[model samples]
Target: MHGPDRDGELWRRSRVAVSPDGDVVGAISVLRNPSHSGRFSVSLEVRPDHRRQGIGTALIEVARGLRPEPLPLSAKAHTTDLAAMALLQAVGGRIYQQCPGRRPDPTSPEIRSWAGIQAVPSGVRLDPLNGVTADALAVAWVAQYLWSHEAWSPVTSPDTLAQRLREGLADLDPATSTGAWIGDELVATSLVLREPDGAVTLVAETIRRDQPDGVRLVAAALARCMTLLGDAAVTNVLIDGHESDLHLAPVLATLPPTPAEPLLLVEIP
Candidate 1:
């Protein structure tokens, strides 16, 4: 291990890697996303100078040893990081999702045209995060719980899920977090958080597959978030769409996002 384990509030956990000579070389983090259930979303990184030294691999092994069992691990890599991809494959990771990269300008006319297509699915109405009541949130959580099973993830405690929502709405600001509802049932939701650098990022955007509104909820949330980011020139839009989410893959594929590498995922066997 490179340093002491970092255990943060709200169930976030991480471990670091150290070189044989006592130098910190890399690290790995696992977000036990309550929505994803059993699988942990993993990120592995090694210092550039430590390339090909097995540091990344070692870090993964360490992380796996420390995480929950029967829960397969997942990590993302870009095409530019050939070494990382190779290392992941050498250790049995396979690409599961293709994450889209950012474009130079999110405000471009072409992308601006996408908003219409991503608008609210039929029969669904959008509501601000602040207006959502506990009962409604429970409906969203239940929808997520059912979705998690299909995605092969474990459904976390309702309290944990609610806490996750609070952190998101607070971190992203309720003005930017919005949900989709049909009558009283929460069917879809999307929340965006703005980086200090001024670029906005998508935090949560989901709609129940069974709902007629489909994935259009993301469009409504996105349009609202972009409006919330008024005056900020949004040249970049970052989306992390893993392969596990089949619904998101097509959206990324159809768009001409900025010239950047797509995300690749590997699953530990």
Candidate 2:
């Protein structure tokens, strides 16, 4: 019963299903990650009345058909959403990562002391990625560090890294993403993404292998980002990386530990 939109842009990478009464009952967005090949993330929302109907399944079928071959799909759903959990399992999608949401206690004396300590070294410089000519290199270095240490899927090209940097930078309202430099070398980086529910999640953080001071630089950058978000009742600052990444242990000690969900990497034959 779905019909075309008058403006023709209703569901470009998504699909919409309308009931006979002209109500939009279901919708899902199919998105491709510029950094990862043959991978896609899907966001689905269904109206309450349409829940029992097979509309959700049908929409997923349509989404699958639209994807390129050897397609791999993934999504993030709340641990409490039984229906969605069921649907994803039925579609061969398993829990990739169970991130524990965390919040900052700005008034805590420990946090204050940690804040007071100069995490960044005296000689190193930290700044927002601006019109610097080495921006591409900086992005690539950070991306490589993240993929190698954090167990993230490989990002093969500098152009892909650049594209991801641009998209992530654009998402920040006050621009929280930053790059740290040791002279001309890009040594550390972090990006704070503000969720719709007012929680700021740290999406990615990477430090160069040889840069012993990179951890402090990353911590400093996150502290600055927290200040920029203001007094908005900030909750959980979620961050996840490989369990064996030792360079980040000092930084992780600063936050509360939530049980991490194991991510399964399946290569399609």
Candidate 3:
């Protein structure tokens, strides 16, 4: 596993060990969303058979020396997975947040109705994914950061923001990333990403947390994503909520969303 693969700006992932045959035995990843600095996160993986062998600890050693001033790190692990959970705790991990994974049964009448917002909020409109431009997306990022309540870095200048937007756009599946608009300003954003398992996850960002129609705008974004899904059934949706976000948890709770997994943040000492 060869990488520290410089992903987009401010991100890199590294593989610390590989077997003689070249299979990945262990790896470590570093991610600092310009939006989340002290809250930066890292992920570590070791072949199951290789655990109890101290690889996780060694990798932590490498991660502790990470560049850009050694900010705190976070990672998610399943709640019931004892080994994974224990390994993280061994390294001082704790539950900073818990985002339940929900599989929204697309056939449910409730969800079906959300596909097209019955009543879009006043003076605001949901824009098609195609309607989003780079500048608007950058603005959306700023909004997400502001509304997010996570203490991460704010985009500082036009050039830096533009570059970050370009990098983000390259990773977005435009058909799935939709926006909310007030006149020309992009006020909110949502993305439904299709994972390799064929499950689509719903994530949303609204600039104004208190907007009267904030919740509906998110629903509209998911609705548009459902349109892109076409006939393929969406059997899984993972809703990740930060401790401070006001809407996601409550809205998803209405789906009576079940607790599918417990997301744990492993604190790197």
| lDDT (tens digit, per residue) of candidate 3 on 1-269 | 23556655566657567777977788887666554555556777888888888888888778777656657776767778788788788887767665565556565555666564435567877766676666666666656655465443234344554565556565566666677778976666776555565555666757776666677766666566655554356545665555346655555655533436655555555
Q: What is the lDDT of residue 218 in candidate 1?
A: 56
Provide the global lDDT of candidate 3 against the true structure.
0.64
Q: In model 2, what is the error at residue 228, expressed in angstroms?
A: 8.2
Best by lDDT: 3
In order, what lDDT does every prediction score?
A: 0.61, 0.58, 0.64
Off by over 4 Å in 3: 1-35, 39-41, 65-70, 113-119, 122-124, 152-165, 170-178, 181-186, 193-199, 220-243, 258-262
lDDT of 3 at 76: 69
What TM-score does candidate 1 get on C-alpha atoms? 0.68
Misplaced by over 4 Å in model 2 are 1-13, 20-22, 105-107, 116-150, 167-186, 190-204, 209-217, 220-250, 256-269
Worst 10 residues of 3 by lDDT: 149-158
Off by over 4 Å in 1: 1-47, 54-72, 101-104, 116-124, 127-130, 133-142, 145-149, 156-158, 195-199, 203-207, 224-232, 243-256, 259-261
Sort every candidate by TM-score, greatest first. 3, 1, 2
**Candidate numbers sorted by lDDT from highest down:** 3, 1, 2
Quote the lDDT for 14 in model 2: 68
